[model samples]
Target: MINIANTKTSSTEQKNTPMAFLELAFRPFFLCASFFSIISLLLWGAMLNGSFTADVYGGALWWHKHEMLFGFVSAIIVGFLLTAVQNWTGVRSLNGKGLLGLFILWLLGRVLFLMPVNLSPWFIILVDITFLPLAAAALAYPIIQVKLWRNLMFIPILLIMTLINIVMHYSIVSQSPQLMNNASTAMVLLVTLIMTIMGGRVFPMFTANGTQTPRVNAVGWLEKVVIITTLVALIISFNIIDLPTEFKAGIYFIAAVAHAARAFRWKVWVTLKTPLVWSLHFSYWCIAIGLLLFGVAELSATVSQSQAVHLLTVGAMGTMILSMISRVSLGHTGRAIVASKLMTFAFITIILSTIFRVFGSYFLTDYSQVINTAIVFWVIAYGCFVYIYLPILTKAKPGY
Candidate 1:
């Protein structure tokens, strides 16, 4: 029961404010996440073509994976949740110097990952691992004060993500590829679970409001089944439970079906007229499809795990983040919730990027070309976001 209402501010309050950017958590975080994602993708593209080389913490492959999840995606998650929690619990989240400190802590972790000078692994871990727990604490305080027990689920999820991040960094120290791979997969699933929970809460409401349609009621039993199955799939992904391949596949398949059914109740077809709404629906479908493909990969020789993962990462996470930020930034800033024409094009481009990255691998002969093409689209998509939203994020809302 998180409230999604817009916060109102007086024009006099916002006018002539010197440090408006640091006045809220979303401003600095959303801006930084967009820029960081663009740079990271460019570096990844260069590394793929052998034009760039870097000796960073845990090597380039590890850095790319770790940063995209813990670095890029995690920033957006914290920013969104911190902002939303304010609306949820009717208490102010971090702002001003306090918000800046948390943002700097996250930025420092990213800086350490890219520094040419060899840094102590422990130092990097200490900095990188500190952000989430602090964010969790900030999030928990307001909810606890209000006794909003229903909203407290997010605290544990953040803490668990922190634990997984620690394990990921430790994999580098232990030099265990299996551990690294398992931890990475686990993080992906964990984020997907976050998306599942958040999307279920917000998407239907968003779709109904945006489309002027009646709100669809969620089946309580189905909601619980979807979440429980997703948790089981996540546990299986982490290798925490010893399950047969068939059993694992079954759990994933059930989760996928449950997700699809849940989405079907939202009347996704009607959302085609709205880019902001449709993009979310499409992204959620990617999770359903991704889960099915991932389950198939476990039992079939034809399906590759990387393909399934790319579908979830690029299609589900990337598009959903872009769409959510676009809508949230506008709404929070007192602008209309509609997407600009260019922003709509950016949305389409990112979906294309995911298609090329995931399905192109199956059809194309030159794998490098597929990877590079996807990178180009990704850069264009996020580049548009950074360009269009820069002013909107930096300045006070119009009419304040």
Candidate 2:
């Protein structure tokens, strides 16, 4: 069996002793995510209220979106993936200088994004787009050596996301509104695709394992149809600029069937017992619901696309990512499956935050209020994630 316990001295460790506040997976980025998330949103709030003064290369909206995706999400992605890749592969993993370098690359991206004119587009591109793929490369190296090909597909997705991000930047520089809109839609679709594939594999698997039952790998014809439909819809949605509404809705319905099948595959009856596991199943369901609603918006002319997207972002993505980070960090760190009360509270906070965000999306007539409400959930969800995982990441897994 693969060893989940990590014992090496963390980079945060100094002179044969563990460092406080820097001891585990959650410490550094939780602090970073905590501070950066607040600051990023505050800047966003200011940008919206006509008070924020920072002009990141392209503009406030561009900066806000770019940093939110590339910086904040990227940082969290690296921290979680790097830490887990080590545990997943039993490799020594990136730490010490290697870890430090990756973190610096992330910081530099932020700095370059903030200073608009000093850097060329290429300069900004180099800084912003380099980290995730590099992190993926770092991760894949060990996994590939061990023949973990299944996980390798994530590399190309990471690369494509990087490419899309670059396109977003250059579209800004070129003043190509068309290209910018295309890139924007592509990025969101990429996020959706990620939700589709990763959620498919992990959600059911985690639910089954967490609940101590038969592996609920829903294998059947409907599941196969769902998978196929999801790919077709995602590609058609992203590729076709003015796709016919009827066609898009058909694809969305197929994908929703698939997503819901995946969610239901692992009997949620077993899940309700564990909030951590149930939260994941719940989040995946939200993705299905959001995608279908998005398709409905396109076809029926009733629902708003923005509403569908937020359901994924504020509801599904936020919830699922936080739940996984908490569970993975704890499980890999040699902690028991049982979360501490504080950790449980943190998870609850994120859920409540998600409720606020999703409800605000529909109820709050003002766009700014919607953004404000979403930010709270975003911060709290991630904040709670960081709150629990920081120690788990910093310290080596419990058993030496």
**Residue 389 of model 2: what lDDT?**
64
lDDT, candidates in the order shown: 0.89, 0.68
**327 in model 2: Cα distance from truth in Å?**
1.1
lDDT of 2 by residue, 319-352 (tens): 7666766665666555676656665666676666
What is the Å distance of residue 383 in model 2 from its true position? 2.8
User: Which is the leading candidate under TM-score?
Assistant: 1
- Give the per-residue lDDT of model 1 (tens digit) for 328-351: 899888889999999999999999
List candidate 1 segments past 4 Å from native. Answer: 10-18
Error of 1 at 147 (Å): 2.3
